[model samples]
Target: MALSEIPMGQIRTYGQIGKAISCQSAQAVGTAVSKNPWLILIPCHRVLPSSGHLGNYAVGEDVKCFLLRLEGLRFDNP
Candidate 1:
């Protein structure tokens, strides 16, 4: 899937992923991401909402933040 192609330290919005896979529905992409069982292997953490904020994750938003930070992605004050 497109999620696997997303490099570490970089992120893609649900819409971006959808477009990559020829899907027009961001919500559908979000649903698929939410159901991903191979989180680490697939790097599902790299997917974010289009709002430029950290969105829902399988484990939790904190874990997602930690993962992203480990990959060199820094977040500004919200």
Candidate 2:
């Protein structure tokens, strides 16, 4: 699956995943990610804002940052 393709310690943007899934809008991808019912299985936490802002996660931006940081992925800003 597309989510599984994301490397363990890397980050990806919603727009990138959208393109992979043949969708044109990153917002659409974000919507799909927000609705991902699989939670940890889908690894939706790896998806971020195209501007590298981290955006609003389904849970919260803090949780998203924590998970990414736990994976050793660094971000300049949320």
Candidate 3:
């Protein structure tokens, strides 16, 4: 349900999800995200690193970026 709210051209950090759910730890959220089997269906690619890095993806970072770009989301890493 949380994934359903991620609009196109937007993203949410693992920390944000964790914080919303009262987990208080992005690493734990990342771990749960890693277990997500739906991938693009659930839009896990919309989850970015808290530090603004692209980070890894189950389908690889290149594929992840491609999907985000396809959805018109920008990659603004520092």
Candidate 4:
């Protein structure tokens, strides 16, 4: 899965994904991310901003945090 490629204890910024797939704008990646339909199955919560902020989530940040926590992902102070 594309999301699984993020690793077990790491995260990926939207801009990084955009750069990886030859996209020039992180906003484009963010738009696609917002449309993701797999929810926790695709680990969309693992995708975040480059600043280490939680960013926005259709399912709410709290829920997203819960999911990330379940995956052993920690959001540290940046």
Best by lDDT: 1
Model 4 reaches what TM-score against the true structure?
Answer: 0.84
**Per-residue alpha-carbon lDDT of model 1 for 1-78, expressed as tens digits?**
789999878999999999999999999999999999998999999998888888999898899989999999996415
Candidate 2 lDDT tens digits, 1-78: 688799888878988898898989988888878888876777888888888687877787788788888889876563
The model with the greater lDDT, 1 or 2, is: 1
Candidate 3 ranges beyond 4 A from true positions: 76-78
TM-score attained by model 2: 0.86
Tens digits of lDDT, candidate 3, 12-75: 9988888778898899889888888998778888988878888778878888889988998777
Whose TM-score is higher: candidate 1's or candidate 2's? Answer: 1
For model 2, state the Cα shift of residue 7 in Å. 1.1
Quality of model 4 by C-alpha lDDT: 0.80
> What TM-score fits each model?
0.94, 0.86, 0.89, 0.84
Model 1 steric clash pairs: none
Which is superior by TM-score, 2 or 4? 2
* C-alpha lDDT of candidate 1 relative to the true structure: 0.91
User: Local distance difference test, per candidate?
Assistant: 0.91, 0.82, 0.83, 0.80
Error of 2 at 72 (Å): 0.6
Tens digits of per-residue lDDT for model 4 on 7-78? 765789999888888899999899999998887667778899887888888889888787778778765434
Worst 10 residues of 4 by lDDT: 69-78
